[model samples]
Target chain A: MTSAFALSDHDSAQLPLATELIAVIVASSGGAARILTIGGGDRLPSGPLESRHRSLQSGLRAWVEAQTRHQLGYMEQLYTFADPDRTGSAPNVRVISVSYLGLTRESQKASFSDAGWRDWYRYFPWEDHRAGAPPLIAAAIAPRLSAWAHGATTAALRRERRQRADITFGLNGHRWNEELALHRYELMFEAGLVEEAHRAGADLRERAGLFGRPMVHDHRRILATGIARLRAKIKYRPVVFELMPDEFTLFQLQQTVESLSGRLLHKQNFRRFIEQQQLVEETGDIATETGGRPAKLFRFRREVRIERAIGGTKLPTPRS
Target chain B: MTSAFALSDHDSAQLPLATELIAVIVASSGGAARILTIGGGDRLPSGPLESRHRSLQSGLRAWVEAQTRHQLGYMEQLYTFADPDRTGSAPNVRVISVSYLGLTRESQKASFSDAGWRDWYRYFPWEDHRAGAPPLIAAAIAPRLSAWAHGATTAALRRERRQRADITFGLNGHRWNEELALHRYELMFEAGLVEEAHRAGADLRERAGLFGRPMVHDHRRILATGIARLRAKIKYRPVVFELMPDEFTLFQLQQTVESLSGRLLHKQNFRRFIEQQQLVEETGDIATETGGRPAKLFRFRREVRIERAIGGTKLPTPRS
Candidate 1:
């Protein structure tokens, strides 16, 4: 390491301070990224930290099932912090958020009436470009955003605003990255396209499809944060394993990626990436035909896992 | 997103009639992951989620800071509702944990005598293999673990335990993944190398090493969750930007990754990763050199943030 802690003029100082946690729960089905929803709000299942708990996961598990009534199969910690001077709820109180990204096989449907679940894409309609991106990118968002860009008082500000929109929404022919989920949300929020911004007025809120479903408070922002993290994560680590069944077909796997990304991939390149990576193993089982001849079934190879670090699996996801 | 929500023929619904949350905090200098402590306990900052608050993160922020004066920065949601059964804590009372991951710059040193922060590696010394992994791995761990594997009563149980240990600790010649922060902790807990479970018997606890520091409740475990998440995250996204000042040199950027990951990356590879990914832009500035060449100071390329999603970046680390 460039500078080990032992040699960094460091101290074993402890801060008996407050911290916060959050959760990002995602499951996939029907070629779409689905987040477990509660009470019609697209919030990931979350709660508060307590002294009585034995561990963080234990606390997270309790929170998830209490609302959803289903045990979480795969769970991992996301991020942590104490936001300085965050006002609105408790007076003069400090808040911390510890977030988690959860993945599970969707076996339970919404049972009770009050409790509800929805497709993540429904909230972020523009994310779905599986059918080659919607016309809104060129026709609607660009024109309105162009006006917004010109509205900037200074040239530097205008250029910055234009660049932000272009990179985030992939205007000017940049490849759309499925991973910029959080950036995309923030960009829309900045442009007053989302409902959260009271500044948007009713017209933009109703017409701006670029803005996703409005969330309670920052829940949507938090969801976007999780999506951004997950989008970047699946490329290097075997985290996709958490979202998959023990045994599944490549098509199902690819569909899950597309769903979370809200964009389509070059099929041939994707297959080549999977095959070359040796990420999966032939299970000696075959699935009934979906299109062409019956395809072979495969399971994640447990050994290739230890052979490399975060990446070695050449995922040939073409930008074209 | 095949079939948004899959309904199983068998209906088994689990409901969380109650809620809870936890916070995982980290402050790093050089490259060491910092752990939060309470009453001298190596634990995560935490509290219960109650109706007294308006939003989840807000509630968490309030509780944590109420105890510690330190304000947090760069917080993200970790995980949600972890425990399914209310059996771990109080009976018949449902709970949910909206865990969060937090980062602090640590501008001020810890003043509280009873509360403190410590290097995360001190607890998991073997994790920091920067100058080649600590000898404890093969010398102390492998042999004892083999006996534990053999200690299982049934043959199948023995195999299961052995497989788990191997995968977790990378025993019998397995490559270690620093990102498996939680897995390493869970493995230590299982192996009885951690102080939490072994302290009941003095010898076991002592042998665990500066091994695992005891956390108040499950806070340390929550910290582990945060460490693992951050380690994995730094690879793709520019989250390190959150922790950095407005402008910094490539060396400073590299040191941060080394500290958090506790593993070194090839320097050339790291620089190449930063350049090709276009994560940073030159600010027309240069920093005075301490030794070799004065490194060019660069600002995070806020515009190119979306580009990272299309491709992953490498860190300037010396590969182990």
Candidate 2:
């Protein structure tokens, strides 16, 4: 039995533990969902939690703002990742990364030369179903995943693996669930179909590109977590407003949601659902920039945030 | 601007930052939701993340099972609290507490002499609405909260305070939201209505008793977080089955959900909603233990966990 305080001279107390705050700042623009990234779109803007920072959230905001020069809005803690092998840090030095998801309006070029907003789908192309599930899934992912599933030791294990693949990737008659972004990434990683898996010694470098572009360290995984969180959250919370401009046409609003969710929404159903919730109100103005007939502009009702705690706004995605 | 690597001599790296894992293991029995507690029901079972522990969750489970001699089921990370002043540790030390919410069947007597299960409502009397709003809110809490709201310096500040209070506590025609358990607790703490607030130097020792029993340190706050998470989760996720026995009647299931949610559910609507989800199956047995009539026993369909990631089970609580 191990004692609770069994400090073996190399425990966390003796070893230096660095707390890192990573930000996943998201925005929607030009019919695409984007994320602010540093290091030439390879890593998220992150910094060590310093002594001067009053709280974890403040530390994250400071780090992101300093690096990107883009003010974050509607931030929430996503998750804390502290697996010892996750960062591949020195054995004695542990890194605990607390990640946060921040939403904002359209992106501007960051102050730092390398810091810029990149289309989120660029990293996970298969995730986007706005134009139907990208061809990469059928062309590359399914065959590799099927082989991986059949490679399992026992028939029961093979069945379990195949089922998991079907559920995560929407294969074998399963519906593509936008909320399973993280699960899909994880499954691909397990199947050695992604670059991270190859980097982790899976010996499948050739199969990486079709899956998605990989980021430095675990930034891609963190992004997947952020994507999944936002995808799930927008179905219930009014957080999508944080990423919207002051006013937008119904088409623009629907486009933004579809971009983030990686799936096309039924236009009439989406507008009806939004109207039924009373989450938005007509601005009594029309937008001529929508390219065809002038459409009435709408702004989110900020008062709904106070009136209802949950403020649920169900997305009307057509049943697949 | 402070550099990202601005680490002072007394920063987290040099200072011994103790990583603590706290568990809010919950169950429902005898028409009440109960939580497992140690130190005579004043403290949750917690232990430091030790060197032998492979992961944060494993460390939590190991500590809890060792301390209480009870197995945990269906565990999920609740939140990680890491405010430097949260634990009031020494100037050189910091504490990072990662809390988890676990659900299991009704509690048995724990091996530890002081460990036992206590009704969750004992610590949050105002939270329960199963018998409608408790009288303590009107008799004691309202006046004190009103005074706190009015005590703010400026008129605008006072109005803001009052509005926040009303929104959080469901005052002035606002519908009572069971998921705001943490918000309510925090509001009371800020208003100096809870004993822990008094401990933090708010001179309100006399009014503490009416609020609810207070736990040591920030355990009560953590418990509130757990309660809030569970209440919110049960609406979207079929997690209530984790707290049920192998076989149970629909009435028992509703009671268990009500106990955890602190609100009564509409019987017919709740049963209908459950049936629509198809999350449970009849056990082909009748339970005569249900007082008047023989009730059919049902068990949760565990396979739904694999098929649907977020198998939603909406509790049909009549609108207030």
Candidate No. with top DockQ? 2
Q: TM-scores, in order shown?
A: 0.70, 0.93
- Candidate 1 ranges beyond 4 A from true positions: A1-120, A148-161, A189-253, A276-279, A283-294, A297-314, B1-71, B79-100, B109-117, B199-204, B207-210, B241-252, B275-312
Backbone clash pairs in model 1 (N, Cα, C under 3 Å; residues 3+ apart or in different chains), count: 88
- For model 2, residues A122-185, the per-residue Cα lDDT tens digits are 8999999988888889988898889999999999789878888898888889878888899888
> Largest TM-score belongs to which candidate?
2
Q: What is the C-alpha RMSD of each candidate to the true structure, in Å?
A: 8.7, 2.9
Shift of residue A100 alpha carbon in model 2, Å: 0.7
Please provide, for model 1 over A246-298, each residue's C-alpha lDDT reduced to its tens digit, 9 standing for 90 to 100: 77888888888877776667887887788878889989998886687787898
* Tens-digit lDDT string for candidate 1 (B122-232): 767767867777788777777767787798899977876676667666666766667777877776777776776554445655443456556654556767778887887
Q: Interface root-mean-square deviation for each candidate?
A: 13.1, 3.4
